[model samples]
Target: MMKILIIEDEPSVRVGLSFTLESKGHKITTAENGLDGIRIFEREGFDIVISDLRLPGADGIEVLKSIKNISPDTGVIIMTAFADVKNAVEAMREGAYDYISKPFEPDELLIVIDRFIKHKGLELENIRLKEEIRERERFQHIIGTSPAMQRIFETIEVIAKTDSSVIIYGESGTGKELVANALHNLSPRKDKPFIKINCAAIPETLLESELFGHEKGAFTGAVQRRKGKFEAASGGTIFLDEIGDMPLALQAKLLRVLESHTFERLGGNESLTIDVRVIYATRKNLKDEVKANRFREDLFYRLNVLPITLPPLRDRKEDIPLLVNHFLKMFGEKLEKSDLAVTPGTMDMFMEYDYPGNVRELKHSVEMAATLCKGTKIERWCLPAEIRGDGETPDAVISVFDDLPLTERVKTFEREAIRRVLEETHGKKKEAAKKLGISRETLWRKLKEHGFPVSPSDLEE
Candidate 1:
């Protein structure tokens, strides 16, 4: 089943070896000398090469070196006499796969070849697994190509070089944690620990002790001393999610730590210093929180040095197709459903629907669809009921129609719908027209009439 090259000077030995290997079902190519063997190897691929330690033009070590330099993956077995064992050892040291003693039994040669084949199989499998992992994590787990996402990628690249605190603003389920991870991984402290704690998820009573460390017997449950997120993330990054929900009282202490990189553990006056980079994420607007007297003004400015606002899925819908494909491939492999895909109608519906729950929701929807998919492809009916507009009204726009006349309401809705679709498509008028169920010329005229921004070339039918 394997292609083997036999390079031996003795005609009798070469023929006998070829006969023995061929009888074992291996395809053997015989070469009279080292030079011919090297030439054959260069012209055609072989799984294993067997060469004598002593030869006329090029010796066994020379052949091994040449074969290794050409194809490192090819298994080379050096055949040497008892006295030439030293040279065979040198050949192995130079990268020969293994060495075989001359006048050895056919069983011995077969064993070495079998071992080499198994090892090569394992090596190839390892390479394949690594490539799969790389493909899945191509964008650090953040999948998108919309113009808004492109800008975010650029911003992350520019800011990752520094250790300044950053504030990421986005709606819930918009991958705020993913963005925080990307920033940490892209930064210099990537190798260090990255600790995360949801400010809103943890109770306000224990939030301070969670941010800083606690001494033994500090609180009712403090039976032992413990390090908190900042301590655990020293020399690394700490991601504080839903930071807008952090209690105002704790915000002052957080601001002190951000400004001075020092904080005292609860019930412990001794200040502990740490070199930790902070990344804050929030669904609520801190500016509004500040106006409402819920967030401190000075703390807002301290954390808002580098601000990043992630657009919602509805606002960057052009990336839906790419995200759909990514999740399909991702969950397809997980669910053992190879070659899984979405129908065109399903894809069109995805492009039209506004994802209020953002990328996280889209990912879950794809996962569920892939799980329930009976065929190789996911049909329109396989999608969630909400996506199919069966369970409820598609969006809330219809509720506001009572405030204006019928004509003005219809025109306003049309203009707003076109605008949102265009934004999702990244201003690609052709795709926008298709999603709107209209011709390119009609979409173009509507764009001009509604005063929507678009490229001139995009209007071409």
Candidate 2:
């Protein structure tokens, strides 16, 4: 049930609204004037406040402003006479959620109230989810509050003590390495070494030496004996990233190591006993690779013991705001812009865009925007061209442009376009000019006309 406040100068109207709302399973509070309603609302918070357009002491607009100032999320609806519809519209602009005219049936007002309740329900649930996510935001550099991420976090904790091989499956930049680290950090071997190596980054010719270590003179460059990742990570955890890209020959050797506690160093027959745990991450489907004869079936099955799949950024949109806040704070501190903030448009775009590169792309985007921002606020123009689009105007920008004359509006828009292009090109006039479809001379002319901070150095570039 909702707590509703009704403000009407007419005693009968106030009484009628309160009775009607109470009958619909709402706890109603009534006031004969706007001031009394405001007092009661402040004393006792409400889910909604219904006020009359014309009232003594303060009008409905004043009441709306007061309600919003106190509680920004509370729904406010204005009641107006047919003749005072203009005032009702004005009230809406002042932040009234909706308005209904006098002589309306109770059903009409009830419909508006019902819509507000439903919308409020969703908003409250969103707030709850965010709060729940906040509690787990810094889960060892991995962030997720959504059910998808929470389940993964739980799984990580549940299996932290086990020494099983974990194969993380996710697209690039989905924090696979972070998961590996968490597994090591929370395991019984937390105090031991946690070595990481990228199989795909190291070449095939040197991969065997990298994984199994090598004796002196094993290769032309190997002048001295060196311990491999597995040897170094003994009594700890070894994370093998992009193992799917490992050559078939290397796969067989790795499979041998997985099945045995001892491995031989390159160019040496002596065996070395191992007590290290292994973790693997890849973006490819190993079963398909096995079918294609690019990966060994035995190794795939052995490494797939405790698999964890990380959801992509698009699939976990609920985490975007958390991730954005994280990156903004991180980049803001690095750039020394402590109070960094984003415009509504920037956040709106962040929520709507499909981040194909996952969290890494989002991190880079926030960093770029923070660096390009003239002030603490990251605007829609500060976003990458691909995310915000070069020609797209966000609602906030459209509203600002709506107040300008046609000619001046066009001039201002051009000025902003030039500024964004220049920022993206790092003050390089040649590239910015080309992006704007103009030459250096035209760009320089427009920059001057737009009151840009152009100097002799600008022309040289």
Candidate 3:
């Protein structure tokens, strides 16, 4: 049963509405005035609020504004006997879910309440579904079945429930922004705005106003009051990407907002309060920054309430094939090349190189291969020179020396090159075979003959 609040100054009307709503199997709470109703509404949780338009002390509009300020998700219906179209339009403009006329049929009021309640239910369900989709997308984007990534997933699940500040730390190109998006999408504020500000991208002089808004004539270009990311993200989440690059002066202001959830517009004394969840991501070491006095220690503590570290792609090489396949499908669809397929030899070539640029580099490589491949299959020649060692064909094994006796040299340089490729590719025999210009079966036989490990799992570890 949904909880409904009835706020009307008239004793008879309030009691009648309460009785009718209670009869409909809803738990009802009655208030004699708008002030009392707002207090109860703030102190207690209700699914929907029904407030009379005219009330003593605080008016219905004020109550509706307060309700929206506290919880935008709550459904508010304004009741008015004045019957002024202007008042109804104003109430709707101020975010009232709906307006009800006084002296209305009990069934009419019930229908309005039922419809709004159903809408609220659907809204909540949609938010939940969106969050699930975001989580799935985040997982799909970061292909890693390693223990490190699994732990990160578990941490994301636990922290997404609260509006606490989050700090994500990782190496460059480690997908910190992706993690930030995951946090915002999984949070309760998922349905609301999810604003991202790249602190490093914007100029330091403008970053303050960009975050806390500014009043008209606040600066040279300030002609009218402008809402910043924080205000725009009211009742939602704001992702501060590359926050470690934020100016020291702005960091203090950010700390103030985090401490009180209140901030004044630039060049304005009026302080505005917003309910915004902050998620910060950065590649810089905040602790080192703090020690060097570049980053505020207090602000660091505030943002680092729940810290998450993303493992580098190199650290989880086992995920390379999964990432490759994912990127292949993604870029193929994006480029309209659905028939694009990487030869086993070409894939092996990929395993040989250490992707210093991480997942981003891998994605670019896949897109390039898909674009450059003229034939149905992407060949070794399609891959970059760094990936394809010595630019040899897959089936051709390098001959170290034709003049040297077999007994004089125990190992051929060709065998050494193949072993090096296997090591680089993390032992995925198919990837190794591609790198060595050999078939998967040949690579497997060669590995068995040479006592070299040849599984994706072995390579990953």
Candidate 4:
């Protein structure tokens, strides 16, 4: 376990971070101010020191200097507000490990910590975390390790370099916008502006003006001649979210712009050409919409160059623990419970219950539990009524781990989780391991350790 020190003035934020890290099996210590944080570091060394940029006593930079003076190898992470980002970046020049913005998700910070830990263990010569930071700038929020998600990541990496128009398909709350951001950030237009417009949210009467811009006196609200999203995103990226909701006339206009690379503002004959990369996202199936004559067939074909489908949370049950940990830390910070934990039974309910709203539902569930629970551990009762109301979770699941040692309890939970996945795959060990985000060899060892037969045929029952 890594020893982590949190130095922040806010009690809720400090406790929330402390709880999140502690839940990850790390030893965590907190100081209310930077001066005390430096003194604590002088007495007790730590693997990482996460300090807020501003403090009552010595500031984060001072603490960083003292920590580096004491132990150069120790990683120092600066926590800064949006305004102090420049100072945080400068700290990297002075031997700080990394910097995270205030109110950042717990999982995001964990990714940086994990990256540092991996390098520290390998004793890498260069400790500059800029590359990883760059990688996450657009892609950091996505959380998943299932095979389906892995394939999506690979596809994004390959297609992001090209200026291909991407069509992302996913159920609501499946992170379609995040994928769009990844494509834009990872592409040549990384330095360019990225503008997003939701087609469904705007009225049909104004959708054209919003996308292609409008001239003064073009419509009732046209007070002044203004640029549209495409014009504003010149030589950049324009994400047309909910494009499926675009009317047929506007769809034809969008198609013309795609084919001819030019468009005219509403009530204007003058044509404007733009060099903007286009990305579209939708929760609806365009093919079906086209068949129904709701979406234009030509527009559908134009936008479907490179399609990316995000799997729902239920399909990747193995990633629930990671997602839960992320949400726990986030809500814990807001709720001021740094020692938060979910009971094994409650976790089982979480894993078993299918999230119809996908990751968004799971995130909200964690938030609700964190808000209601008075103690560090979240119990089954703390869960939202809808989850508990389903009443499908087995009492036996909780009873099995009762009074067991911590390690034994964890092992039992792992075995059950693996068994469920194996059953889902119909005894296909390869598929099961991929779903579990583990190597086939590791799965084989786990099967044997859990008193399961090695033969795939044995799992068929």
Identify the candidate with maximal TM-score. 2
Question: Of models 2 and 4, which has the larger lDDT?
Answer: 2
Supply the TM-score for candidate 2.
0.61
lDDT of candidate 3 over 300-348, digit per residue (tens): 8888878999887878877777777778888778767787778887788
Candidate 1's residue-wise lDDT over 48-110, tens digit each? 998888998888888999999999888899998987877877998999888878779989999
Residue lDDT tens for model 2, 320-347: 9888888999888987889999888789
Ranking of candidates on TM-score, top first: 2, 4, 1, 3
TM-score for all predictions?
0.57, 0.61, 0.55, 0.57
Candidate 4 global lDDT: 0.85
What's the residue-level lDDT of 187 in candidate 4? 94
Which residue pairs overlap in candidate 2's backbone?
none
By lDDT, the best candidate is 2
Residue 252 CA displacement from its true place in model 2, Å: 0.7
lDDT of every predicted structure (CA atoms): 0.85, 0.87, 0.80, 0.85
Report how far residue 325 has shifted in candidate 1, in Å. Answer: 0.9
Which has the better TM-score: candidate 2, or candidate 4?
A: 2
Q: Model 4: per-residue lDDT, tens digit, 1-461?
A: 89999999999999999999999999999999988998889889999999998888999898999999999999999989988878987889889999988879999999999999998976753434554434333265677767888788889989999988999999998889989998998899989999999999999988888888889999887989988899999999999999899999888888888999999888788988879999999999999999999998888888898999998888999989878887898888876679899999889888988888888889988986786554698887557545665553545554645888988767766865776676578668989989999988888889888655577553442
How far residue 97's Cα lies from its native spot in candidate 4, in Å, is: 23
